[model samples]
Target: MLEIRPSCERCDKDLDPLSDGAMICTYECTWCRDCAEVLGSCPNCGGEMVQRPIPSAARLAQDPPSTVRVFNPDLMAPTSD
Candidate 1:
């Protein structure tokens, strides 16, 4: 099951599970559309960035989104290779 993370890992922006602004990598690293555009890929794993699936309101009600926020300042820096 997808963690459906609650915020953008890069900018710390609130990302509702139902919002289309959220992007994710295969490893489930979450980011907002803006940050994802700037990055063009996942910094941690070098994986492609894609849109995150939006869960239905009913499904979201049953399985709440993760409240845990992963903010890494180092991740914001540009990486080589």
Candidate 2:
């Protein structure tokens, strides 16, 4: 199951499980669209960036969003591959 992670790993921006702004990699590394595009991949693992599924409100409440957040505020997306 996807943790639907709590925030962007690059920007530390909130990415609610149901937020349309959410993007992720195959490993479920979450980020906001802006960060995801800037990174061009998951910085931690280098997986392709893609849109993440948004859970329904009821489902979200049942599963609850993850409290743990992952980010390196000092890290910036690489400019080149």
Candidate 3:
């Protein structure tokens, strides 16, 4: 299951699970749409952002999943040409 994060690692913006601005890489590295596009991609793995799946309230009510926080804030460095 995806560990839908709570915030963007770059801008520290809130990333609600149901927000359309939310995006994530294969590693579940979360980021906002702006940062993802401006940065040209995920700096950690150079992967592109894709729509994140939100668990239904019914499912969440039954068994809540774990939330993830950014651990490697420096993993993504500014990309230069």
Candidate 4:
């Protein structure tokens, strides 16, 4: 199951569950479209942003789970040589 996060890691902007602005990497690190654009790409792995899957209201009604996930952006920072 995709853990749809609630907010962007960089700016902490709210990410709508159905928003096309939500972007993710292979690691499932989530970001908003603006952050992804300004950052030039996924800072963690250079992955491109794509539309996230939104759960239908029917599906959500069956079992509601928190959309928010804990992600530390600092951990994604590149190490200095």
Candidate 5:
């Protein structure tokens, strides 16, 4: 089952389970569409970003979305070699 993470990993924006603005990578790293557009790809993994599917209300009721927030601001921070 897709984890349906609650917020964007990059910007910490709240992404409701029913929100169409939620974007995710193959690894299930979630992000908002705006951040995904600006980054052009997943920062955690060099994978394509695609709109996440909104689960049906019934499904949501059966299997609730994750409440955990994953914020890693330094995931994209500049690294000195």
Candidate 6:
């Protein structure tokens, strides 16, 4: 089951489980659509990006969305050797 993570790992944007702005990778690392697209893939795992599910109200109540927040500033940093 998806954890429906609370915010974008890049921009720290809040993404409600029912909102269409959420996207996730195979590792369940969450991001907003804009960041997901710009990041291109999960920087921490290099996994494909996909639309996150919008759980029904009952499902949400039973498992409530995760409040955990994740951020990876390196994703937006320029690479250097």
lDDT of 2: 0.82
Clashes of 5: 0
Error of 3 at 63 (Å): 4.1
In order, candidate lDDTs are 0.89, 0.82, 0.76, 0.73, 0.90, 0.86
- Indicate the worst ten consecutive residues by lDDT in candidate 4: 72-81
TM-scores, each model vs. reference: 0.89, 0.85, 0.77, 0.69, 0.89, 0.88
lDDT of 6 by residue, 3-71 (tens): 889999988888888998899988899999998877777787889999998999999999898898987
Tell me the deviation in Å of residue 13 in model 1: 0.8
- Please state every model's RMSD to the true fold in angstroms: 1.7, 1.7, 2.3, 3.8, 2.7, 2.1
Off by over 4 Å in 2: 77-81
lDDT digits (tens) for residues 54-73 of candidate 2 = 88888887888888998887
Cα displacement (Å) at residue 73, model 4:
6.8
Compose the digit string of candidate 3's lDDT tens values, residues 1-81: 567788888878888776788888888888888878877777788887787777787766775645666755563566678
- How much is the lDDT of residue 40 in candidate 6? 79
Tell me, by lDDT, which candidate is best. Answer: 5
Q: How many residue pairs clash in each candidate?
A: 0, 0, 0, 0, 0, 0
- lDDT, candidate 3, at 21: 88
Model 3 clashing residue pairs (backbone): none
> Model 3 residue 19 lDDT?
76
lDDT of 1 by residue, 1-81 (tens): 689988899889999888999999999999999999988888889999999998888888888889999877676777566
Residue range 1-81, candidate 4, lDDT tens digits? 677788888777888777788888877778888777666666677786676777887776775635676566684455444
lDDT winner between 5 and 6, please give it: 5
Q: Distance (Å) between predicted and true CA of 30, model 4?
A: 0.8
